[model samples]
Target: MSDVKRIATRESYGKALVELGKLHENLVVLDADLAGATKTAMFQKEFPERHIDCGIAEGNMIGVAAGLATTGKVPFASSFAMFAAGRAFEQVRNSVGYPKLNVKIGATHAGISVGEDGATHQCNEDIALMRTIPGMVVINPSDDVEAKAAVKAAYEHEGPVYLRFGRLAVPVINDNPEYKFELGKGIVLREGTDVTIIATGLEVSESLEAAKKLEADGISAKVINIHTIKPLDEKLVIESAKETGKVVTVEEHSVIGGLGSAVCDVLSENYPVKVLKIGVNDVFGESGPALELIKKYELDADSIYKKVKAFVS
Candidate 1:
């Protein structure tokens, strides 16, 4: 097996928070007793004065973040995705989303990759929950570099934002220094004519690998990295769908109300095309090794390759 460096998005988020803290003195961080797990400890260590540990109260954390935002402080509130989106839904919708506060929700350990945490901890519907809130900028980064850059973008953004990071360590796909991350824009990783693979989060790397396998089989595949789910790149999605004629959406979240559904909504309204959605199929996640769960849920690279091949054939 070829060795490629792997690091969790949560790790990147933690490091980026510290980096952002250096540049923006007004940046503050809050964690609902998951600083270590969410990797917010990195920022906590560097800027303890600005970090607040909310002691497992996810809802309270959101409330505090909103309060801070009004004081002109950019608060990055974090918790496991399950609590951040589920437990604090009302608070986020009412306090942050309603007022359009400048708070950032760093939801870590999202998707089936939370591994041994079982159904209760693995939050597959966070993206759906986040996007429903009006004016909430939803971002699910694909890798370490993208996740790092996304944190900075969220900090600079004016309104409420949700940044989803995975628990599992994934390969660095956007290692190119020239790669610029723009909110609401999709990046085309590979261009092809047969089909387009639009993916986000940890699934983006899998889609890229699947594209390589597809090429060996004489099938051309286009891979588009969609880091931002809300305010999606409708222009790029329409153009790619028009060119390739077939589209496949891969995401680590539930198939419903996530990237797949979002992309289909764009295509159906504009340029109609066939779309194969590869995701959790609206089911809860179970406990297992992260990689094992990935294969079982049909989100692995081999599974993605097989599914895409069958779709194209």
Candidate 2:
């Protein structure tokens, strides 16, 4: 992981969109006037003809994406998570999700990692909103590699998809040359019998670091990366829960309706194991440095280690 380069998942999504644009002529990219910040500017620069800046109108952009989908074009709608998932909720729900249109919503700047932008710009409920839409695929990638692969997967999949990306640069933990990104599959990064740590997004890398610290304390911890949120890999979650007997879920989103709640739902019905969810306690994030905010919210490596230690006891 240390040898690998650090890059934001949003950056990876931008580069992937550009590469995918080269492969598919019908691939259209749309942004709500934040391409440079969301990194969709990368695609606009390469294919200005196909890239549409729908100004600041996120709702209108979603409708346009759905209309384009009806015409057999794969439209990737881009915007900040708050506006894309919040302001455009009605449009996305009816136009794209309800009709099962072949539109992909690339929601950037999701979660608290949006940093100094404060609570209004930070979107902590995007996952919950997308999960409610029937047949919508929700993917939150763990690293640059996964982000790129998830974007391609969303393009190939025939239906509405919500792809979440972060603003903060995260360490690459899935540098295993053999690592492959599947749509609904969860990968167990570390094998341990004591406790299992289920995490997604930036917390995936932080959880890995926490696992190392737990290992030193003679508390072996298994780390699982769940890049796909909606169509969760129930088999991996249940099997890991059964093996470890205890589970700890970590994420940068709210504990209410994000990865932690999703994991608990799976375990409670199938394996019935205890799960400790470490996330924002249904509270808004404040303006601060991204890394410092992560630590303040207790979403960092040390916080995970401490929480899991208390849980396993």
Candidate 3:
């Protein structure tokens, strides 16, 4: 147990990239014209020659990043998830993903948390798209510590990867910098037997809060953080479901083929637990505050508590 703090996932990327850049000169950063906003500017300041600002054209940026990867350079292309996954999808699929290049696509402002930016900026389907790509690894880190750990892990992992994160500050759950983080492994934050709430990204913090709130109401909730979405920790998920009997999956992304879907895909085959999903219900988010958007889409802790309560009762 550690003191809770508030921080954005994007800041973690900037901080982590700078540290990695210092250690490895091959760690190059590319931005689709949004260095300042996406925080790639930090890397730009540290490694000017290694930072490439490929203005606005996300497709061309992907092509260039893939080329850099071919030359034994690790390129982390920074942009909003919307443009990275939507606009340059074809380029990402053809060049980077198809070849399984050693490139890290760090897309910030993901999900509905890109507040007041509306649907065009907030991307809720990036995970589904990136996870579907063959040989592509999709990761959505829970907090600043996990985000930094993910950056380091992505650098070591050889192939095309997608790291989705948000601009808004959420609660910092992991305090120990020494906490072991492995790819495709789930972290059990809290243990219980009544039900299991599997969550990822910002939803992980919400799930922890929901678990605490549920405990006050006499419900024992199991909270697990699924940081890796593509190669999901099916063993942990299935084992948790077997213990809980019922489960609830939550994420800032859509319920369709995201966290919830991935959990269901695992449980249905082995454990077979009743799952209630909490996420953006397959619709675009409108312009509003990030908290308001999360509330509207039922992606908060209260919503998760309510949904799990219903499933249990």
| Top candidate when judged by lDDT against the true structure | 1
List the candidates' TM-scores in order: 0.99, 0.98, 0.97
Ranking of models by TM-score = 1, 2, 3
Order the candidate numbers by lDDT, best to worst: 1, 2, 3
User: What's the TM for model 2?
Assistant: 0.98
- Which residues of candidate 1, in runs, are more than 4 Å off? none
Clashing pairs in 2: none
For model 2, how does the per-residue alpha-carbon lDDT over 157-249 read when each residue is reduced to its tens digit? 999999999998998777678899899999989999999999999999999999999999999999999999989999999999889899999
lDDT of 2: 0.93
List of clashing residue pairs for candidate 3: none
Q: What is the C-alpha local distance difference test score of each model?
A: 0.95, 0.93, 0.91
Superposed Cα RMSD, model 1:
0.8
Error of 1 at 37 (Å): 0.7
lDDT of 1 by residue, 183-302 (tens): 999999999999999999999999999999999999999999999999899999999998999999999999999999999999999999999999998788899999999999999999
